[model samples]
Target: MRFKYSIPVVFVLALVIIEKENNIISKVSDKLVLKQPPMVLDSSSSLQLLLKPNQSVPSFHFHPRTSAPVFTLMKRRLEDYSSHQPRTQKPKQKHILLLATTRTGSSFVGEFFNQQGDNMFYLFEPLWHVEKMLTLEGGGTNASASAKAYRNVLQQLFLCDFSLLESFIDPPPVDHITSNLFRRWSSSSLCADSVCSPFVQGDFEKFHCKARKCGPLNLTLAAQSCRAKQHRAIKSVRVRQLDMLRPLAEDPRLDVKFIHLVRDPRAVLASRMVAFEKYKNWKEWGTRGGDVPLDDDEVMKLKGNCDNIRMSAQTGLRQPKWLRGRYLLVRYEDIARFPMRKAAEMYRFAGMPFTPQVKSWIARNTQVSPKEASGVYSLQRNSSEHVEKWRFSLPFKIAQVVQRVCRPTLKLFGYKVVNSEKMLTDRSISLIEDKVFNSL
Candidate 1:
């Protein structure tokens, strides 16, 4: 008797051998859900089986030759995927850092990246924890010390290493788990099911979060989530200067892009007064109806913020060797008026695909009534209407003081100077100049 091998027999043997030799899922028998193919299939050429929803896994079939009638099933080898192939250079990952101060529309702009869907892991003020923990631990808040610590924490976080972050959390998390991630709810990637669970209550108080049951997300789990993401973005208002971030930006292991966001200095002071209780004194001073000297501690504090903002932008605009093709300057006023257009630019600058989801979010967020997004930190707003609210809120005298103190910054960024009280309050007159600030 002669031994003859049929195509089915050879195919079964091949599938078994592939399964034994490789780590990839053997598509024929694994319970993987089959997705519908784009076209009808045939055996003469390799083709995907058209599948319906809930369809069972199907065999992959092909004919070895045009003259033969034999049909065969085959499993894709582990090496078949482009990702598994040996490469001379690894693909660069997008790591974006949005540098801005409080009241510069940082939160609003951050949503552009955060809503890029599941492939993005967003960090909303991870430095908030570092700042709080350092303050409690007696770590001085001097510029050098603070910037150094911030730089270190950011570097590790981008790498998905949570240990450095865990060390900074007060009332340390147990077994690399914690519920106190600052606004942990803000990052959907962190709140995903694989990394977090419903908060439980006890002496330790099982992570009870009101907005979502998610709490006590494991640092290990968070790291896993971050690693799974193709890109990471950090939005922070605490970084006083762009130069402080040079080490992280220049690291050979990472590709980092910076979006330097700025707003008018006078508007910043006006918004800060309403949003921060610590500014009550400044509020009182504004309401006291007198000339505020440029040298007042409060005024100087505002001036310092302006100085940092201007300097950082000027540095980025210069496009230093380190920052070339990695820096962008964005004004809140421009974004407020054309939310979707500016969002596309920022996404392009970061070298990330601009997704339809972000476009939809911008459309909904920018056109809504202010009441729906009126909270001090709410991301939603009628953007065009909201930017000018500060104009009416800041008294003329206070505005004049800001103009004098933040003059250099204001002029550098092309804000129209209001020469009189009437010019300051007239909403009919546009205060923002139609000048473009380029980072290239």
Candidate 2:
């Protein structure tokens, strides 16, 4: 009786082992089945049933002994499904850099690009903060390092990265009467279409912004708007050297193009003097503090700036054919005299179509009368009238000084020198009133 009982126990143990081996084989078959078509789901079908689009896991009957393996296979199939899904491709954006100096009508040119449409994004003086940072870090005097830093900042900006511009986004307190108007103006102009739009339009119900304060929301919107554009442009007066931007111009990823905006140095000088005087009067009234007083040093600095502008233009025009193809020299005078014609050419150079909307914008902005409130500094002005104002505004002595200093620059840009003494005694001088001269 003891021997018979032991034999039954041995037979039972052998059957259990065989069952375990079958379960292992079933799991292997399930995995192999994944490789076959989903239609092949007969009894011989391997693990691939999990991949069928409409099939439910609960609909399939698994052997009770192999339930754990079925659950494991289901989990893996879900993961594989997720991993095999398609991904979206990012849209390619064009990058444009406008090379110019201060008071060269760069603002107008920048705005032209910005106003092209909702699809175009423009940045104004993005390098201002970089210059400030360099000064604070004692790298301002290091030309090579400063240029490299500027290029890096520009690269990040072209890629729609605004993380680096956070500190510079702070607007002045509106209550601070001594804040520089020009600084406020620059910040306001730069953020107008983007960060400050809702606030500026008094759309409090839509967006809330504290008086003269810009928060993260502003930066985010600006970055998003920039990233959404098919074309991106940045205008800077700090980058006076074309060579400083050679690497960016040649960058394969950027599809970069350069617009070298040249202005008559004499006109530039005259404008600077007039602006300096106005700034001085503003400072004297204590409406602003930390203003740079016009002194011999300031004069020398202005002269140096003019020289650099001239040199950059001259150098760019003289570049070799391969490099020259990437650059387009646009004269402030020509743009002022014939905005629509030049604008079309500029758009073509930028590889964009000159649409009707752009034409309408050009007409609206460039057709203002000479007596308009913002005729002096506003982007909206009678282009011809505004361009010729310098001729009447600069005094004979000042004109002579500017002419002598900027002779080569003026010649390079094809600007004819006016006879200062003759002009001073002419009827043109009679047209400008004492009030206009004082205003200048």
lDDT tens readout by residue for model 1, 1-440: 11133334444444445545443334432322243232322232112232223433234333456432222123333224423645577556899999899888898899898899988999889998777865634443667777888999999989999898888887788999776778777777776777766556552433333455665778898888899899999999888888888998789888999988899988888888999998887888788966676677778888888898889999999989988898899999999998888899998888889999899989988988867988988889998898778888898888888888899999888899998888988989999998887652
- True-vs-predicted CA distance for residue 236, candidate 1, Å: 0.8
Deviation (Å) of 176 in candidate 1: 0.7
lDDT of 1: 0.77
What's the TM-score of every candidate structure?
A: 0.77, 0.62
lDDT of 2 by residue, 1-440 (tens): 54334333433433343343544544554464454344333443332232334423232333367654333454354445444657577655668788887678988877678676767777767777767656744344467776887887888888887665543433432321112212323323234456553333432221233255432244555667777678888888888577778778767778788888878776776677666674353223223344334454545555677788776766666765545566788888788888999888888888877878778878898887656636456778888777767666665655555666667776666666667567644645432211100000
Runs of candidate 1 with Cα error greater than 4 angstroms are: 1-91, 136-140, 201-211
Clashing pairs in 2: 30-47, 33-46, 34-48
The whole-model C-alpha lDDT of candidate 2 against the native structure comes to 0.62
Considering every candidate listed, which one attains the maximal TM-score? 1
Q: Where does candidate 1 clash, by residue pair?
A: 200-206
Q: Which stretches of candidate 2 lie over 4 Å from their true place?
A: 1-92, 136-142, 167-218, 277-296, 373-376, 424-440
